[model samples]
Target chain A: MLETLPLSLDAVRDVAKECFDDGWRLVTMSANQIDDAHFDVIYHYDKDLTMKHYRLTVPKETVVPSISPVYFAALLVENEIRDQFGICFSDIVLDFGGALYLEEEVRAMPFCKVSVAQKQS
Target chain B: MARTILPFGPQHPVLPEPLHLKLTIENETVVEALPTLGYVHRGLEKLCEIRDFNQMIQIVERVCGICSCLHALCYCEGVEQIMGVEVPRRAKYLRTIWGELHRMHSHLLWLGLFADAFGFESLFMQFWRIRERIMDIMEATCGNRVVVSVNVIGGVRRDLSPEQCQWIEEQLAISEKELKQLSDTILSDYTVKKRTVGVGVLTKEQAYQLGAAGPTLRGSGWAQDVRQTGYAAFGELGFEPIVEYGCDSYARSAVRFRETLQSIDLVRLAIARMPAGETAADVAGAMEDDTPKPVSAGERRDIMQAYNRDKRHRFVTAPPPNLDLPAGHVAAKVKGKPDGEAVTRVEQPRGELLYYIKGNGSKNMERVRIRTPTFANIPPLLAMLPGCELADVPVIVLSIDPCISCTER
Candidate 1:
């Protein structure tokens, strides 16, 4: 019956903490850059007792904050967000570069990139 | 001081889709699994901007081939939420019919892959053969083999005749017999039990919290099914998520196999109870010149609400021959002017799928991001792999039914 609809960036950690504490493991983190100025990242939670959704937004060009320290699943989704969108996580376990599936050419397209998307300056 | 980094698949033999994962394995155990995705982001959100709401279903279906109809289902549901259109009752039942049919085939396909994972050629071959019957039913009812184009904004594009319904029932009957045999063998077979049982156990508690969706979560003793949302015409119909509590690979297989049988029953029920009604809505395009107008939020909500009524639908909402999806919704300036952004989540076949759509109300979307199930479920996979022998990786991974395309798409 509880729907998070859309959560704020400041509340991202609190929601993740509560969801994880409440026994809902973080499944995946989905993100997309709205434009050059803003980015939206969604943390998907999976718990038997609860079925709901939550999200957070960050500045598109800002340095990456590590959610992986709190949730491991966050790392995979982060890597994907970085690759497609070119947003870089400041410090983490892996570099998470290269086209996991896409090719060099496809990666160059604006639409082909993702949340932590990177474009040549 | 020593860790082996192994790159597994973008196009490996075991994997059907192209997901490149780099696993830091120590002594055959995964220390860390780094997944590299985004090979499949086809700019669907941007495509949404260029393509009118009507053509979006065909585009959305291509997002995930395995769950093509469901992709359309989620998109329609999302749009319908914005618009407030009410679809007819008959269209809802028919949508359920195709949706269940898609679930059965997808699970059957995964079952075959699981069997193949352990090199059980006979079981693999047998399971796949039965899947063909379901595909035949799909072709008979919808025409296309995989993309089924059954979802339109207002309702389905076609309806089932009495004879077609009877034929579908008969084929489902045949599929049930084979699926039952398959489940029996999977449950009692020593080889399968030896390989799958107790392997990759994701406790019910774990399944729910992880935001896992579909059979993967359900197989682990947790009930997380999207059909319960009753999108399309599911509100009038009755269906349950096929579940198992064994929390192992075997149980996962059983959940899918059993669900295949359930789908047959559901299809029979839908066909038997179907009421006659108009399959397509009148959607005609009335655009004389390239005139652009800002669509009001109220209009957007109405359009999405209308779509909600058409959820899980297999028909297309054709704007009365001349008038297409109002150019108002298309050329209209949105609230954000590319300032506002939103994320969309749906229960995909594998698990929870997230699509982040950000628009600038421009010709192209500002950004589009997706969170696929495999990427999210990878953590549990690493947790399941540490103690198991390297041989079990294939089966355990297969249990999740990772469609790297969805992850990348």
Candidate 2:
């Protein structure tokens, strides 16, 4: 009984702004790497204990726009997705430069099954 | 006037966990605070790829020491939902009892730590002294003090006898009376109030906008708790979320203190109303014939391998003959691999703990994403840090009840 609204990468910012203006709280975001080339990212929002999810499929090379300006709480989870999936986010309020949890030398996403060398090449 | 940067923690007198925060201060007032984590990151989520869905229940229990039972409950609930398994009513009530016991102990531990954060030595000892009673209750019921691995996908592994239930009530009565004795000091003492009453104020608007959960949200006058969703036996228990409008550290402390008393009442109610029946649903076909039968060669091999893998039971050399597999052996086997996905939320002592589980009709899960309560509360903690004095940093940090281990996991 999980419901989600399909969203394009371009519509993420607009939906976030709409949710913020209409009194919705940003709950959290979760990302799943579907394959080596694609990832599915979900944004969860809440109002009065009711939750809504907006999901978009992104290519690994795509840079999703940051919603941190609309919801400041999105910064941390966004950085976490960046570190874990290697999905770049643009215009984050506080960018950890992909070192939020990993060291600088740890260049690969630990969550992804592909080897670091395979991912880079 | 130039701002000076001070690095706090990774190791500090006030914090037992390693949470490093860089505080930029002008004179005595903090202008900005930046948190750096990863000190205790164990990459536990990745283990799901190797561990089967059944063993992940024990894995999630290690997420947090204080709320281990609730974590296991949440994971089991998620998997059950995915597989369309209905937990029995008696099992639901049992989960309620153990979950509340964990809440009581976690709050007591936090209260002791909160007291110690402000240099109240004797009060710290007093709170933990009462906490031991609840730990004893858990040990007596579930056989382990902290990580009571009693929750299975279909139901609970352990059941309580009537005598044991009566004994738990007696122990809880003693703990409740002792806790009431410290109420006046914790609520109205001049020093306790001065340090916490107005120290870290988070207004209702700011709290909601920043995604605060549990007591942090309730402490700011929001009647929002995941328990209200009635995942377990709470639906029948007439549960109501506790709210305090003080919007400060003291408000958060009062919320937790009052909740400890609420948990005691809840445990007693769950036991009294528990129905008499089978405690768990027979997910596997093993429950059809309960007679003590000789172990089959294939099943015996599986048991030996299981015993070898389990570190706690590894001392045993071989499987015993005519293994009397008890009733409610729900953990022994599951019908088939779970397919599809489920998102389950449980009300942990800290706040709402969420699990996103996906199974592709395989032993290994496609993904298992955990969103701990501490992760959501960090932004609100950051909002409260600025405009506070340097000496009050620990008071504000402790207010959120940050579990760095849970967060970094």
| Candidate 2: segments with Cα more than 4 A from true spot | A116-121, B284-332
Question: How far does residue B151 in candidate 2 sit from its true spot (Å)?
Answer: 0.5
Q: What is candidate 2's CA lDDT for residue A23?
A: 95
Winning candidate number (TM-score): 2
Model 1, range A34-96, lDDT digits (tens) per residue? Answer: 455676666656554244666566776555665666665576666666655565565444445
lDDT digits (tens) for residues B106-170 of candidate 1: 87888888888888889889988998888877876777777898877656767776667767787
Model 2 scores a TM of: 0.91
- Tens digit of lDDT per residue, candidate 2, span B201-256? 99999999999999999999999998888998999999999999999999999999
Cα RMSDs, all models: 9.8, 6.3
Q: Specify the CAPRI tier of model 2.
A: medium
